[model samples]
Target: MLGYAAMNRTLREHDPPRRCNRDMRKKTWQRDGIERAAELTEQNFEDLYAILQWNLDHGIYLYRCSSTLVPWNSQFELRELPNYERIASLAESCGDLIEANGMRLTFHPSHWCKLASESTDTVERSVESVEHHGRWLDLLGLPRSPRYGINVHIGAHYGDKAATADRFCKVVDNLPPRARARLVVENDDKESLWSVSELVEEVADEVQIPVTFDYHHHSFSAREHSYREAFALARETWGDVRPVTHYSEPARLHGDFDARPQEHAEHVAAVPAWLRAESDVMIESHGKEESLLRIQT
Candidate 1:
C-alpha cells in the first residue's frame, strides 16, 4: 500500500529522468504551438509505459499521476485542436495499462490551485483547474470518486478562517458534478491553517469532500492528537474508499544541515508504529521509487 511519485530514479532502463515536458519556454499556443504539445504527449506515454512496466514487475500498485503529463494542459486551451483526440486516445491507452496492472492513480495539483481564495477570480480559476483534472480522469475512464481524485488544499484565509471555510464550501457547491465528485481536500503542513480535525469540522462536514491526511503535516499541526486518533478521524472521512495518506520525512529532522524543517527528505525517516491496517500511501520524497523501496524493506 505504498508507492512513489513519478520518475523511478533507480531504474536506468528509462533514459530521461522525468516524462513531462517544460521546454516550451516562451512559446504561446498561438505561435510556439500544439506541435510540441503533440510531441510531448506521445513522449509522455512512451516514458509512462516504462514506469508502469517497472511498477508492475516490482509489484508496486499505487502511483501518483504527474500534473504535467499533458504539456501546458491547464494553461492552454486545447480542446479545439485537431489532434487533441489523438492525445486523449494515447492517454486512454496509458489508463488501460494502469487498470490492467491494478494500480491506483491520484493527482495533486500545484500549490496555486487554491479553492478557497478570497478573490472570486482565483476561486474560478481553481474551479477550472479541478475541471481540467476531472476531464483527464474521464479520458482515463476512471470513476468520479476519491479512488481517482484531484487532491487540493484550502487556500489562504485572508484573516478570517470561518469565512474562508464558508467560501470553500460555496466553491464546492458550484462545481459541476464531475469535478465535485473528484475533489479531496488535504490538511496542509503549515500551522496557520488546516489540520485534519479542522478540515473535518469546517469543510468535510459542510459538503462531503473526503480528507487526505498527511502524517508529516499532522506532526507539524497535530493539535495534540495521537497519531492513531488523528488517522482514525481521517479514515472516517473517506466513507467507502480506502484512505490514502501522505508520508515523508523532513530533511532537517534527519541530520541535513541546511534543509528547512518542512522539506521532504530523500528517504522515509520513519513510519508511525500504529500503521498496521490496509491503506494506501503516496510516498512524498526526493528519492522517488528508491525511497519507497527502502521504506518497504
Candidate 2:
C-alpha cells in the first residue's frame, strides 16, 4: 500500500480545515500551560480521526501521523491533559478504525530525536520523544508491533559511528515496551551518516528492530549498494512484517534545479512497481496526500 505523511490537502480544504498537527510555541505553552495543550490535543485527535477516515475513503491506508499531535507532550504525561478522558476516547476510536480496516499507521518523530547523542541531556530528551510516540500508538490501542511502527532516524554520527550505534542500541534495549516494541530506524540521507547496510549490521542486528529503507536517501548514502539491493537488505530485517520505505524525488530533479539534494519535491511522479507491491511506500513529497492522489490517477 502507498501512503503519505501528515496533512491531507483535500480534507484541509473543508469548512474548518481538517489537519491534526496542531502546535504551539514554547513561550505560548509557558504562558497558557496545560489548558492550551488540552485544547490543541482535543482538536488534533478529532482531526486525526477525520484524517484517517478521509484516507481510507481515498484508498490510502498508510500514514505517518504528526509528532505534534499533542502539543507540549514532552513536558508532561498524556494522562495529565485537562480533557484526558475525551482525548483518550478520540484516540481509541481512531485506533479502532485502523484495526478494523487493517490500515497501517505510524509516527516519525522530529529530527532532533538523536538517541545516540554525546550529551546525556540530549539523549534523555530523545528517549522521551520516542517514548511519547509509542504511548500514542498504545493509546490508539494498536498492537505492540512494528506493523504499527514508531519510525525514526539515527541521523547524527557525532564524529563516531561505532560509539553512536552502541549508545543508540543501549537506549533501545532499555526503552519502555510501548516504545521499544514498535520502534524502527530509518537510513539517513548523507553519505557520512547511516546507510541501509550499516543500519542492518549495526542497529537492527544489535537491537532486533527492523530497518526502514528510504529510496531517495539511499542515493546519497548508497554505500555501493543498488536501490533494490539496499531495499532487500532492509526488508530482511523486518522479519514477517512488510518493511516501510520512503520514496520521493529531489526537488532538484523535480524542476527546482537550485534546490538542495535533500529537499523533496512538491510531487513525486510515481513509485517503482516493486516498492508499491512489496512494501508500503510513503510518498514524501511536499504535496502530502495530494501527491499520492496524483500518483493513483
Candidate 3:
C-alpha cells in the first residue's frame, strides 16, 4: 500500500496542472506572410530535385533541403558523388532556379541524434555545427542568395531549463551577426524542456533570436495550450520580423514519426487571423504532392 501511494505521488508530481490564462487567449497575425512549403519523404536526391523543379514551375516560393541530400554530417565520411565542384555547381544551379522564381531555401539539420551520438552533448555541438555549416555556405556564396537560412530545435532536456536557455544564448551570441541573424530556433516534442512558449520567451529575452513557430511542435509539446495562445505568445515575443514558421500533423507518440500528412489549408484555417498577418508559414508535411494540393485548395 505504501509503495502504491508513493508511485501515485511521483506521477502526480511529474504531471502538473495546465496553466491557461486569459492573456494567452488573444489572436495574433503575421504581417506580409509567405506560404513556404517543403518536399519531405524517405526519397533520395533525384526525387527531391524533380520536386524542386515542379515547385519552381508552380511559383512556390519557399522550400527546405533535406539534410540527407547535403554533406552535413562530419562523423562518417560518405562516398563522394562525382566531384566537390559538381556538388557546389548543383547548389548554385538550384539557387539560380529559386532566384528566377523569386523563391527561398531553408535547411534543417537532421535530428540531434543523427548529427552526433546520443551521448554527445548537443547544445554546444549543435551551435558549433551551425557555425561550421555557415562557413561552408559563405564559401559556396549561398548566403548571398535572396533568402537562405538554417532551422534548428531548442536543445534536449539535459539539466535545468534556465541553464540550457543561457547556454543557447551564449552559442547564438558567438556566431557572426549575419550568421546569427539567419539562425531560427524551433520548439521540439514534449520530451524536450523548451516547449513553444518557453522557447519564445527564452530566445526573446536572452538571445534576442527569432522564433520559428512550428504548429505541430506547439500542439504536441503543450497539449493544453490552445493554438490561439501559441500564436499570441509567438507574436508577443518576436514582432515584425516575419518569422519562418513550420506546420505538420501532430505525431502520435511524441517523436519524429509523423502519423499523417498535415492538411495545410485546414491547419492554415485554424491559424488565428492575427498570426496569419505577421508570419511566413512553411508546411512540413509527409507527402509533398498531397500537402501542396491541400495548401492550394
Candidate 4:
C-alpha cells in the first residue's frame, strides 16, 4: 500500500542492525557466509547472494540485480523456483551482506510482456510484481541497496508510436514517483515499432527516468547506427541519468528461426575500450560468465 518513497523511508527508519554477526565475521574473509546462507535458502536467494559474494570477494562492488527468471513464463502462477519464503529471506539476508560489504544492488524486472500481448492482468501483474520485489528489498532494508531499476520494452506502437508513448507515459505517471523514477525503457528487438530514440523523444520532456541501451538489440534490429551514436543519443536524451547499456553477442538467424548465440569477435574486442569509458555494462549472454572471463583474458 505504501508508495515506493514512503516504503524507502520506512526501510531507512527500520534499518537492520549494523554489527556483523558471528557468522559474518568468521566468513568475512573467506566469502563463505553468502554461500552458506544461500544453501540454507532458495535458488533466487542463492543466485543473488552468490553474485554479491563473488563481487565482494573480488572487489567488483558495482553490480545490478535482474529478475529475468523470477516470473519466467506467461502463467504467473509458476515461478522459476517455488519457495517464496526462502527467496524473500535470502533477499533480506543478501541486503544485510551487501550493506556490510559496502556495495549496492539494482534490479531489473522480467520481460514478461515481451512474450505475450499486453493485457490489464499483464500490466497490473507486472506492476504488482515490481512492488512486491521492492518490498522484499525493503524488508531486507535493501530498498535503496542497488537503487531499484525496472527495465522494460517500449511495447507495440499499435497504430501510432506517439500514442503508444503517451499511453506508456500515462501508465508510468500513475505509479509511485519512486518506482516511476526507477523504471527504465530498453530498446527492443526489431519487431517493435517503438525504438529507443522514439521512447526517449516521447518521455524525455516529461519524466526523469533513464534509458537502457541494449546493444545487441540494436545490432539485431539493424538500426544502422553505430554504438557511439546510440550511446550519444542515450546520453543526450537522458543527460545525467544515463541509460544502463546491455552488451551481448549478436544472435544468428537460420531461416525463420533464430540460431543460438554466436560470438562477435570484433564486438568483444571493442568492449574493453568502451567499458573503460563507461561506468556500467550488463552482459546479457547465455554464456555470460564465460564471456566475462574471455573479456578479462
Cα-based RMSD of the predictions, in order?
Answer: 2.1, 1.0, 16.7, 11.7
lDDT of 3 by residue, 60-80 (tens): 566665444433333322223
lDDT leader: 2
Which candidate has the top score in TM-score? 2
For each candidate, the alpha-carbon lDDT, in order, equals 0.78, 0.92, 0.50, 0.52
Assess every candidate by TM-score. Answer: 0.92, 0.98, 0.63, 0.66
- lDDT per residue, candidate 2, 94-132, as tens digits? 999999998999999888888888889988999999898
- Cα-based RMSD of candidate 2: 1.0
Which residue ranges in model 3 land beyond 4 Å of their true spot? 1-50, 72-82, 113-125, 144-147, 176-179, 221-225, 235-241, 251-277
Whole-model lDDT, model 4:
0.52
User: Candidate 2, which segments miss by more than 4 Å at Cα?
Assistant: none
User: Model 3 lDDT vs. the true structure?
Assistant: 0.50
By TM-score, rank the candidates, best first: 2, 1, 4, 3
Pick by TM-score: 2 or 3, better one: 2
The superposed Cα distance between candidate 4 and the true structure at residue 268, in angstroms, equals 4.7
lDDT of 4 by residue, 115-182 (tens): 12346777787676665455545645654322445666765666776666776777777776446656
Encode model 1's per-residue lDDT on 57-145: one tens digit a residue.
88788888777667766566657545777767777777888877768878888899898897778877788888887887887777788
